[model samples]
Target: MEIDGQPLWVAPSIYVDSKEQGIISLGHRCVLSEHVMLLTHDFSLDRYSEKMGIAPSDMEYETKGKIRIGDYAFIGIRSIIMPGVTIGDGAIVGAGSVVTKSVGDGMVVAGNPARELGTVESAWERNQAQWQLKRRRP
Candidate 1:
């Protein structure tokens, strides 16, 4: 759907876990792959809940911060992005990766902690070459 000129696709199963508010800002054409989770809250085990006067539910806690995914970004399937993260423009998060930090623009990252796997420029160039080769074949 288009929200103020930004196209966002939130998967039906995508869960936004937050307390105060859950904000998912998808820049132009930001696609939230299947089973992707955007978390906005966190609670310490030692912390107490004001309502229950007891430990808070693991899924229910005060919001830590908001999450913003930049423009033209592709998040692979089953990626879990933690609270207070701003994923830079054109960044790609590989599938099944746990993102604890903000991703830089034009970078492809993967793995549990999400380390930089490659630069966007290199990946683009490689894709272009492959496209050209395929074009020449037919």
Candidate 2:
């Protein structure tokens, strides 16, 4: 489903990690890649129930947050995006990155914690070049 021309790439294997319904609003031209998981739940071991030594099911959990991916955002393959994060317009997430916070517009990021690598425009240009090169081969 799309909202205002934005594309939400919800794959078959992707599940919203929240027991609560996840609300997503994608801006214009946002593209979520395959196998990307949008997370909304965080489990803590601090607060626990005496009986099972586990947190109650209805305990105070921060699970209600909207994930907003801005215009022209490209989430790479197998990336896990946490809740309440707004990926800015034109930001590019490298493949397998775990996004924990908001990304700036036109920025490119990668790694387990998703650090800034470069600009999205630069990455896009490089990717296009690589795709063209591959097309010409064989």
Q: Tens-digit lDDT track for model 1 on 52-72?
A: 666545544455767888887
TM-score computed on alpha carbons, candidate 2: 0.72
TM-score for each model: 0.73, 0.72
C-alpha RMSD for every candidate: 5.5, 4.6
lDDT of 1 at 78: 95
Task: State the lDDT of candidate 2 residue by residue for 42-86, as single tens digits.
Answer: 545334453465656566534446787888888888998887787
TM-score of 1: 0.73
For model 2, the stretches where C-alpha displacement exceeds 4 angstroms are 8-10, 18-22, 45-60, 124-128, 133-138
What is the lDDT for 46 in model 1?
A: 37
Report the CA-based lDDT of candidate 2 relative to the real structure. Answer: 0.75
Task: Name every residue pair that clashes in candidate 2.
Answer: none
In model 1, pairs of residues that clash are none
Residue 103, candidate 2: alpha-carbon lDDT: 96
